[model samples]
Target: MRNSYRIALAGNPNTGKSTLFNALTGLRQHTGNWAGKTIALAEGTVEHKGKTFQLIDLPGTYSLFSNSIDEEVARNYIVFEKPDVTLVVLDATSLERNFNLALQVLEMTTNVIVCINLIDIAEKQGIKINERILTKRLGVPVIKLSARNKIGFPLLLDTIDRLVTGAIECQPIPTVYQDHIEEEIKKMEPRVSAIIGDRLSARWVSLRLLDGDEKLLQEITKRLGEGRE
Candidate 1:
């Protein structure tokens, strides 16, 4: 029997996330609205290296911190669903703006692959990115490609396979917060760990608590039961 993995594609609007999903899955795709929500959901299957990967294209949003429905859907899915890998597509031409979402996703999940799409356009506009340095800094694989043109698909597949199969170990470097905020996180981490334990990242849970994200707190309580907290 062939193994299967679930992958989520996340990024800001106009980042070519859907384009990459289509390239990877071709005609093997389906779309529908998320349960109890108006946001559309796209999922597709791709077979590579004797394994099948189910890719979910999440709604595009500027930042997961926003309270918009799209942001909530994207954030909640990654935090609760816990996909095998979260592939974050970035617009290479506007990396600075696009990176905001990338960094936010990294905070929520360590299983991430930064896909810098639109490399062809970036090059045409005299923009360049150092993937190696980025990978080292983020402590996750960074792939550059023109998704529309199908460049770098092979490498992307290999990286995804390696990550999902545990052939490659990923140790994401946590983002540094303000000193006071870090202190609060350190204090709350133990309690958060006791609540969610290994089901979610303790530090991230602590941060959410500090941010007073009522919706996320409510979701956590609902999912894990009110007594868990």
Candidate 2:
């Protein structure tokens, strides 16, 4: 039997996300609209080192807060589908903006890899990023690459292989909110964990609740209720 893994590629628009997807999957990609939504979904398959990986390229979005249909589609797949690894590709020139989505994904799941794309542009613009510092800060493996040039793909694939095979472990540190929000999260986490168990991060669920994300709350409630009965 062939070993297989599922990966989700997420990022903001114009981060070379589609470029990386095309590079990795070549002719093995398929596209379709998301279920009941106008946003498009692309999925492809790639085999590396004798392992088959199914990569789902989510629609580009600024964040996973579901402010838009694209955001909702991306967030739903990462949270509900729970792919083996979620790769957040970021534009190196705009790390501040792109980092927001990366942090949000970290809160949802620990199995994450931060891909810093557009390094060549950053270099031309005289912008420097310390991958070591980023990896240390995020508590996840950080890879710097020019996806357009297909640089660092081997390392990316190796990292994915290790993560999927449990050869490397990831334990992302959750982002700390303000004091009041932290207190609320502490109070709500246990209850959220009781409902969702380990399938989703309790802290993230609590954060969503505090933010009054009615749609996500409804979906979680419905899924938990159905699971119970």
Candidate 3:
């Protein structure tokens, strides 16, 4: 495996995210608990076109607001130690809720790909997803697949290769909020920007702060101090 590329998998629980990760790397998946957190994350490395890429499977959750420990695990990886690219998996049958988490991760990291999983089930349920429309709307590539069948893995890998290597540029889709929140973001952002710089959007960080995630807030504050030191 080449040393240049790294990726992370994130999504809501039962989105077939784990199955996809297993299919991608097979026996290569490594498991361990995150420091100070009992929850575990599985990581693996895969080679595509002579390039080696590391992939981490994060605990599935509906949001990154840290409502649960699993959600915190996903949030931490995207925010502080943002991976090179994050695959946001969405269940074809439950896209609206899945899109929520995807949108949150986009704020933390620029490189994102939406994996629309379980197309088989969706089709049976008469749910038709316009992948092209989803891709255009999110400003990221959308890969439709049924992990169990190993369908679309090659195309997904090819797209990911382009994303991590900079052959394609991913600009996160803009998120809209109430006018008052937008005003607050504009005001609080500069304060956070001094630390995260161009790597993270301060407006998004401010939203996380407002959500009252004390642990994450402390982590950000610590990083800010470390940056200055």
Candidate 4:
């Protein structure tokens, strides 16, 4: 486990997720598609904190539902591969919407860090964000970034260090949905917990399944079955 850490970068479209990946990996990145899917996967390795870290740049998508190849690819990697850490990038200039994806991913695993990018643009637009408040609310490290300018890259690396080394902790800001949804989650949560164990968040898995995220459900079922006798 100490030899290498795999980190997945997930986020919505045009959120500067790829730009950040490029910054982190430089010319080291290589691309390939999912085994049977058309969706492309970009991966690179970098030495950090005396350990080799494998960074996967997952396709940007609005949600985890299997509505498109990109979403399915991203969802499958996180749910099945179970990477060591997932850094969900959010566009600082449009966080109100981009953040929905961050919250969604947090539900999947506690190993999530919210990378808020484009802060330079947000400030120029007169938008002010309290990083401490956001971090507190998300229960995850929130690092500000301007990928183009290479600002906050060190902070991002530090946050990743905390996550991969198990120094930082993430607790999903609890969500309470309508009665029917809550009831459904109640039914699925225990079953998922009994299957996947606690590394994968049961509530998040339930929500993904409820929303017809086949990529996740299929991956979970496959992994769980393998663990059985």
Best by lDDT: 1
lDDT of 1: 0.92
Residue pairs clashing in model 2 are none
Query: 85-169, model 1: which lDDT tens digit per residue?
Result: 9999999999999988888889899889999999999999999899999999999999999999999999999999999888897
Candidate 1 runs further than 4 Å off:
226-229
Q: Is candidate 1 or candidate 3 better by TM-score?
A: 1
lDDT of 3 by residue, 96-207 (tens): 8778888888777788999999999999999999999888988989999999899889999999888876789987678989999888888889987886787667788888
**Candidates sorted by lDDT, descending order?**
1, 2, 3, 4
How does model 3 score by TM-score? 0.93
Name the candidate, 2 or 3, with the larger TM-score value: 2
lDDT of 4 by residue, 170-221 (tens): 7767767999999999999999898778757788888877888766667667
User: Model 3: clashing residue pairs?
Assistant: 2-52
In order, candidate lDDTs are 0.92, 0.91, 0.85, 0.83
Candidate 2 lDDT by residue in tens digits, 1-229: 4499999999999999999999999999999988888888899999999999999999898889958878888998999888999999999999999998999999988899999999999999999999988888889999999988999899999999999888999889778878988999999999989878898988898898889999998888777787889
